[model samples]
Target: MDIAEINLQSRYVFRERISLMVLLCASSGRGFQVIPTSGMTLRSRSEHHLSNGDKYKDNVNALLLVATLVATVAFAAGFTVPGGFSSSPPNLGMAILANELDFCYFLLCNTLAMQCSVVAIVALIWAQLGDPELIHRAFHLALPSLFVALISMSAAFLFGVVATRRSHNNFLFNVVFNTVTAIFFHVMVLLLGPYVIPQLPGVPFL
Candidate 1:
C-alpha cells in the first residue's frame, strides 16, 4: 500500500481502539465525569434568553431553512454520484472518491442542520415557556416536528438493518435514502413553525 493508504489505515485503527476504550469506560459506570477546563458543566446547563423579537426568530428560521436546503441537496446529489460509479467497472478510484464524499458531505451537512434546529427550538422554548396560554398549542405545533424526527430516526434504523441484511453494495441508494429522508423530515419540521407556532396561547410570537 502507498503511504497515504497506510496512514489512513493506521488512523482508522486508532479511532477503532479509542472507540473501544470509550465503550469500556462508559460501561464501567465509575461515575467519572471529568470536567473540561472550560467549565463544561456551566456550558451544559447554560440558559438562553429567547426574545420575541421578530428579527431574531426570523434569523433562526432562515438559518433552519438554509441548512435544511443545503443538507437535502448534498445528500441527494452525493448519493447519485457515488452510486453511479459502481456501475462502471475499472473505476474503483472514482467510486471510492464518490462514496467517501457522499458519506462525508451528507454527514456533515445533516449534523450541522440538526444542531442548528435544536438550538432554535431551545430558543423558542425559552421565549415561550411558562405561559399557560400556550402549553397545548405550542405542543401541537412542535408535535409534528417531534413526530417527524422520530419517523426519520426510525427510518435510519430500518435502513441500517435492511441494508446490512441484504449486504447491499449500492452506496448511493443507502446514502441518498438515509440523508434525503432525514433532511426532508427536518425541513418539514422547521416549516411547521408558522402554522402551529401562532397557535401558542399565552406565548406571544416574537
Candidate 2:
C-alpha cells in the first residue's frame, strides 16, 4: 500500500514478467528472433532517452566546453615553462627548468592533463553524435579522463610553482608553499578519490 511496498511489488512483478518472457522464448523455436528484437528495443530506448532529453544535451555541452578549455590551457602551459626559457646560443629558447627534476614532473603532469582533457573532449563529441551506445561509452571514458586531467593539472600547478621559486633562499616561503601544496593535494584526493577510483575499470572492490 505504501510507496516502498508498491515499489517492491512492482519490481517483483517486472522480474516475474521478464522470467516468463525468457521461459517462453526458450520454449519457442523463435528464441533467436526474440533476442535481436529485445536488444534493438533496449538500444532504441537508450538512444531516445539520451537524444530527446534537453537536459542531457545541455549538460554534455557544458562539460565539453570545460574540457576543451582545460585542454587548451594545458597545451599552452606545456609550451611556456616556468621562469621562461634560455635564449643563449647553444640553448636558444630552451626551458630554463629543463634540467630540474620538478620541471620534468611538471611536464609529465601537464602533458597527462592535456592528453586526458583531449580524450574527454573527444568522448563528449562522440556522445553528441546521437549514438546511445557511444554515449554510454563516452561517459565511462569521459568521467575518468576528466578526473585524471583535473588531478594532473593540479599537480602541474604545484610543480610549476615550486620550480619557479626553487632558487630562492627563503626557507619560510618554501615551507609555506610546500605546506599549501600538500594541503591542496590532500584536499583534491579526498574530494575526488572516492568518486573517481571506484569508477575506474579493473579496480577491485573492497
State the lDDT of candidate 1 residue by residue for 1-206, as single tens digits: 12222232212343443343343334445544321111101111112222222223443354345435444543554344333355466774364443443344544444444544454355346434443224223333333343343344334334334433334577987797778777876775565433222222222331
The most accurate candidate by lDDT is: 2
Q: What is the lDDT of candidate 1?
A: 0.39
My TM-score estimates for the predictions, one after another, are 0.26, 0.69
Per-candidate local distance difference test: 0.39, 0.67
User: Model 2, range 1-206, lDDT digits (tens) per residue?
Assistant: 12222232212343453443343344444312222111111222233544343434665787798899889989999888887989897889999889988889999999999999999999999888766567656766776688799989989988888888756789899889889888988898766554334221222220
**Each prediction's number of clashing residue pairs:** 4, 0
In terms of TM-score, which candidate is strongest?
Answer: 2
Q: Which parts of model 1 have CA positions greater than 4 angstroms off?
A: 1-120, 163-166, 169-206
lDDT of 1 at 38: 13
